[model samples]
Target: EDQVTQSPEALRLQEGESSSLNCSYTVSGLRGLFWYRQDPGKGPEFLFTLYSAGEEKEKERLKATLTKKESFLHITAPKPEDSATYLCAVQERKTSYDKVIFGPGTSLSVIP
Candidate 1:
């Protein structure tokens, strides 16, 4: 079975502050890792997809990077609008199909 863990369960940051969120995983075979952001009462919004180690993607103030054992989502000069729960999902390679495993998620609060 594939498993993922997100660190700091929750984070509090002042507006314009920057930080990095962690997502670590363990699986038999990894297909890819996905990043998402969810606001209260809304479904997770797709952020980035990483296929292999050393891969990176960015959107506005958010940047996601992947490694062999874990992935990181870095927030640069974030604003209150960026405050949301960040999630990391991993797709495990299966014989017939792919199984996705999602991390618990890290809730972020940015105060102005």
Candidate 2:
């Protein structure tokens, strides 16, 4: 079975503060790792797709990196508008569809 765990279930930061969220996972026949940001009552918005170890992607104040067994979402100089729940998911090499497993998520609150 594939599984994902995120640390610091919730985080509070002052404006301009920076932090990192961790996503640890274990999966067989790894295919890809995904990062997303979700707002209250909204679906997750895709942020990145990491296909292999050492892969990384960035957008605005967010950066996502992947390794063999984990991934990180680094937030730099975050603002109140950046506050949201960040999600991490993984897709394994499987024949069936909907093989992606999502982590509970890290809820971030940036106070202005």
Best by TM-score: 1
**Residue-pair clash count for candidate 1:** 0
- lDDT (Cα) of model 2: 0.93
Q: State TM-scores per candidate.
A: 0.97, 0.95
Candidate 2 residue runs with Cα over 4 Å from true position: 95-98
Q: For model 1, how does the per-residue alpha-carbon lDDT over 1-112 read when each residue is reduced to its tens digit?
A: 4699999899999999999999999998989999999999999999999999999999899999999999999999989999999999999998999999999999999999
Where does model 1 exceed 4 Å of error?
A: none
Per-residue CA lDDT of model 2 for 1-112, tens digit only, reads: 6799998899999999999999999988778999999999999999899999998899999999999999999999999999999999998877776488999999999999
* Alpha-carbon deviation at 28 in model 1, angstroms: 1.3
Report RMSD (Å) for each prediction in the order shown.
Answer: 0.7, 1.2
